[model samples]
Target: MTLNWQCIVVDCDDPRQLAAWWAELLGWRLTHAGDDESVLEPAEGSPQDGVSPDMLFVKVPEGKAAKNRLHMDLRPDDQAAEVARAEALGATRVDLGRPDDASWVTMADPEGNEFCILRAFTPEELATLE
Candidate 1:
């Protein structure tokens, strides 16, 4: 059997804060919260399957350093506008080997998780870029 990809869980010191931040950034909704964990999922009636992926922000003792082994890449419907919007939402730029001419912008979350903002490209546009 083939396994389908599910949620990309992030480890954070503050689960509520990080979940809130990511939910806002992704336009998702806070589906669940607990004393030690919080979960954010696509908004109500959103196309995503109703299963809310736990963004386990477990209590950790140490701070984050170095690059993450797994990271997310978001492509907004509007590339330029979304870049400015994401900046306003508290994401910071991080240089991670992207060429100057590359179309994707690399950014880090509040907890220093590395993710990329790729220009949304149509099938035709993607072919041209490649």
Candidate 2:
């Protein structure tokens, strides 16, 4: 049997704040537990709606010091707008050695976890990549 991917747990100092930021960024639903943990999932009837795994956040003692070994790459229809919106939500631009003509922009959340905002690829481009 094949396995399915589920959940991405991020360790942060403040799960609520980080989770809120992510929820806002993705326009997803946020659920906070009493144990300083939070989950971000696609809202009902939304595009992702129950098909995607939840992004989880849990509080830890140590703070973020290094870059993430596993980072998210998000593709948006309007890359510039999404980047601007993410910045308004406390995400900062990060330079990950990308070229000036790169189609992706790297950004870090308020807690310094890195993720990327990528331009939406055309069907032809995606097919070519495959």
Candidate 3:
């Protein structure tokens, strides 16, 4: 038996704001919206429409206190450009380690979710690492 993953849900103080920030960062589209919830899915006509799972943002009362056990690792086609773009969108660098490393940059979302920005790697590079 196999189970399929649907969406990655995140608890946030403001679902709409967090959803908007993620949607812009990933170039995704808002698929569902409610008073206290929002969902961001791959853009229309995107090849990831069926393969990638949507992100669900839910309203929460408490704030995040510690590090997240699970976090996203984003890979942009252009690392430098994407980092600048994310910074302009209000994401701040958290400085996990190795700020000079060209491989990846760690950043926190508007709601303080820590996620990494990975440089685009080719299939060969991925295989080599594996």
CA RMSD, predictions in order: 3.5, 2.5, 2.8
lDDT of 3 at 12: 90
Best lDDT among the predictions, by candidate number: 3
lDDT of 2 at 125: 84
Candidate 2 lDDT by residue in tens digits, 1-130: 9998788899999888888879888988886643579888888788687788899999999999887999999989889999999998889999878899998999999999999999988989889978
Q: Give candidate 1 misplaced runs (Cα > 4 Å).
A: 1-6, 51-54, 123-130
Clashing pairs in 1: none
Q: Model 3: per-residue lDDT, tens digit, 79-116?
A: 88998999999999886555474588988999899998
- For model 1, residues 3-116, the per-residue Cα lDDT tens digits are 855566777888888888888887888777665777777887776647644355554667887888888788777888887887898988888888989988888888888888
Candidate with the larger lDDT of 1 and 2: 2
Ranking by lDDT: 3, 2, 1
